[model samples]
Target: MSPSVLLRWALRDSARGVTASWIGGLGYQAGLILLPWCLGRALDEGITPGDRSPLLSWAAATLAVSVALTGAEFAMRWWATLAGVRTGNRLLLRLSERVLGWDAVTAHRFSAGDLVTRGTRDVEQITIWISTVPSLASGVLGLFTVLVVVATLDPMLAVVGLGTVPLLIAVNLWYPRRYEAANAALSAAHGARADAVEDLLSASTAVRGLGGEQVLVERHHEASATVHDRTLALARIAAGWAANAPFVPWLATAAGLAFGGLAVLDGRFSVGGLVSFASWMTLLGRQVMMLTFRFGQLGDAWTAAGRIEAVLSAESEMSDKATSLLPAGALATDGVSVELPDREPLRLPDLSVGPGEFVAVVGPVGTGKTTLLRLLARLADPSTGAIRYGGTDLRDAAIADVRDTITIVGQRPLLLSGTIAENLRLGRTELTDGQLREACRIAGILEHIESLPEGFATEVGERGSTVSGGQLQRLALARGLLRGARVLLLDDVTSAVDARTEQRILDGLRELDVTIVFATSRTAVRDRADRVVDLGVHDGELVSHG
Candidate 1:
């Protein structure tokens, strides 16, 4: 959806709070506008004419207006704050839901850090804009009220007030476009910097091992410098508009003072009338400054909304039709090929695997073993053809059903930051400790895990950084085994383990009733398979032997 449409929907969602805030703001402005009139009444009747009765009455009126102003101000701020927070939280949840559902291809469209900034800082800008809306509306309304009040006192003073509008308009006419462009540039710079920082954190170990810390540090520094420059640019534009816009109102105020002072001296304007107009001129100056700042905030939010819109607009290439149900039978591929970006299409030869069979796919590097397994597991869809499970086209079946039936474990296993057992069980909190240990034992990682200080409760750190590569692979494999899937697609999961552990894992697999499709270059794995599908590069094409 476009940013405007998104904002409209958000406003509707928070309509009650926003409306209450606006009402409070209007009340506050009314109280402020009335205070000057009350002061004028006190000066004219009590001070000038020396009437105790009028003085006492106007004083009470002034006190009442002050009390109402305090209450209205509190209500205005309270409602604006609550409304902004509610809208921000709703937007954050929506963005998170969309991000979590992304496929690998869709996820790669943005860096992790960029997505993080979009969900956080970008949403915050929109929230700030929401909170500013009531204040801006009230300020404008109050300024108009001041002009109307002054026109009644004297036409000359009203002319002075009206004169500022053109000046304020001239001051602001060039600011919106400039501020918006600067804000957008700054947002992009922030996203880039966030991406650079994430890269530094995630790849610091590998970069230091290669003695390339300087390279990463230099890249981060460059990104930081760009962010700094863009921020300064946006700030300068905003400051210029703020500094200049309010000054026009001040000039108008000075002109009103000079004109009203002459009128008072000539007995054409009363002393009380001059007092009220001068007070209004001062208030109007502040309102002009406040409105300019709010407009700048609006520009900031507009740019942020566009950035957020970009993420929400992405479309997943995979189809998710559930018209056909997956059935129990052999798994097969027909004219399957995947067209990768800037590379030759990866072609998989037609093949069939019977139920409960052990099939090993042997191939060298870049032979498309991983790609083939990904398609089989429905992690991705084939670009050119179909893969069938029980004669049902994989695309035609529900994605959830396919994933529940087949689980694929990659070479580099991902373990979230948690205890070893927690990572193994994932969300299946119902699984007992015995069940977890059984899966780990089958994967040949239980011995190592038990040797740790915390045993099964050992923390793996982020992405299993605290564990060895072999241990990570084992943990992931164990987790997959616990699922009890009908078919298991493993992409060289044992690549990090020793030969002995590899053999143990293979032996453990023999005890399971599930169909196994293993992709690897290891002879130890191919020798033990019931059948081997050998993939080799021929001339300019990839071919497979069944």
Candidate 2:
């Protein structure tokens, strides 16, 4: 999507709030114009003639207008803030939805830190533009209001006010493109720095083992230096423009003062009219300054909008037309092949497994064992064949239905910072406590959990740091079992456990009435399976044995 389309989408999402904010801004600008006019009326009709009663009446009118202006300004601010927050939230939701639906290959294109920055810092940049819209609108309306009032006071003074408009327009047009380019560069640098820092922290152990801490530090320093330099360049441009902005309005004010004063002396203008004209010119100056600042914000927002659009516009791997329900039976792959970028294609022989059979896939490292499992799980699509379950192509079935029917446990178990029960019920929240414990028993983790101080209520630290590696794997197994999927795919899930523990876990798994496909290199694991598929000697082929 283009930046314009992205901006339009954001506006559409927050249309109601934006419309209300515009209304409030219009009212605020009207009040601003009226305040100076009321003061001028009091000076001309009452104060000048020394009429105490009329002067008192006009004074009270001016005070009332000031209070009204304050109220209008408050309303404008409130509405603008509401619009900004709502738009930011909507964008965040849309980005998250898109990211969640992406296939593994598509997701690998973005770093975790980059995605976070786009969802947070980039959204905030866009919100800045949305919030500033009302102010920009009010300034524009006020500029016109001032011009009309000044023209009424004296046509010559109106010409002086009008002179600033073209200059301001020229400055706005020239600055935004340059400023936006600089801002985009700075944003890129910042995202890079964030990614480097996140990587360093996440892999601190490996960095220390390899003694590459200095290398990572130097990389982060380079990214930070780029950001600092870009920021300085952007600041210089802003400073230059700001220094010139005040001069436009002040020059107009000087012209109005000199000419309007002479006009008053020539009996063509009143003293009150001259004072009102000067005040209007000053107000116009302030409007120009506000618009200049908003224009800069607008430039930054455009850059951010483009970045966000790139993510939103990416093609999703899942098919929207896949609405058929997946049936239960045998699983098969026909002429399956996967071709990754710059890597040789992995082609598998035609294979089939009966429903409820336990099958083990054994292959050497880099033999595409995990890739085959991912294909079967629909985490990726095969480049050249179809994966079928129960005689129906998975491509024809709804992705959500297919995923609901299959559970995959990766080599590395992932657990959130929550109680053991909480993690077990993540996939199926309606599971009773008895069911949770039953699943834990089936995964051979019940005794371990019961031995803990809090039993099932024990808190797993972030990423399951509180648990041992083997325990973490067992917890992941229990969570998957709770889902009760028809098919279970495990990728070296028992690698961390001892042989006896691994045998016990396998024995428990064999009792379940479900199809199991596990990849392993251990002879004990392969021997336990009802059938085994060997990928170690056939190049890309699969040789099966019972």
The alpha-carbon RMSD values of the candidates against the true structure, listed in the order shown, are 3.5, 2.6
Model 1 agreement with the true structure over 1-546: per-residue lDDT tens digits: 667876776678777887888899999999989998899888887674645787888999999999999999999889988998999899998888777666789989999889988998999998988887888888888878877887888889988888888888888898999999998888889999899898888888887878778787888999999999999998899999999988887888788889999999999998888888888888888888889989998887888888888888787677788665455678888889889889989888777877888888876788888988988988888888899988888888877788788899999879999998889888898999999989998999989988888898889999999888888899999999998888999989999999999999999998888889999988888878888887674422323333
Model 1 scores a C-alpha lDDT of: 0.86
The global C-alpha lDDT for each of the candidates, from Candidate 1 onward, is 0.86, 0.83
Worst 10 residues of 2 by lDDT: 537-546
Instruction: State the lDDT of candidate 2 residue by residue for 1-546, as single tens digits.
Output: 678888888778777777788888887888778877877788788684645998898889988888888888888888888999989988999999999888987898888878888888899988878888887877787888787777777778878888787987787777777888888888787788889887777666577968788888887888789878998999998887776786788898999999999998999988877877777788887777887888888888888999899899887776654665445688888999988779888887566877888888988898878988888889988999898998778888888778888889888988998889888888566799999888888778888889999999999988898898889988998888887789999988898888988888999998999999998887878888888887776743444556
Q: Pick the candidate with the highest TM-score.
A: 2
Q: For model 1, what is the error of residue 262's alpha carbon versus the real structure, in angstroms, after optimal superposition? A: 2.1
CA lDDT of 506 in candidate 1? 97
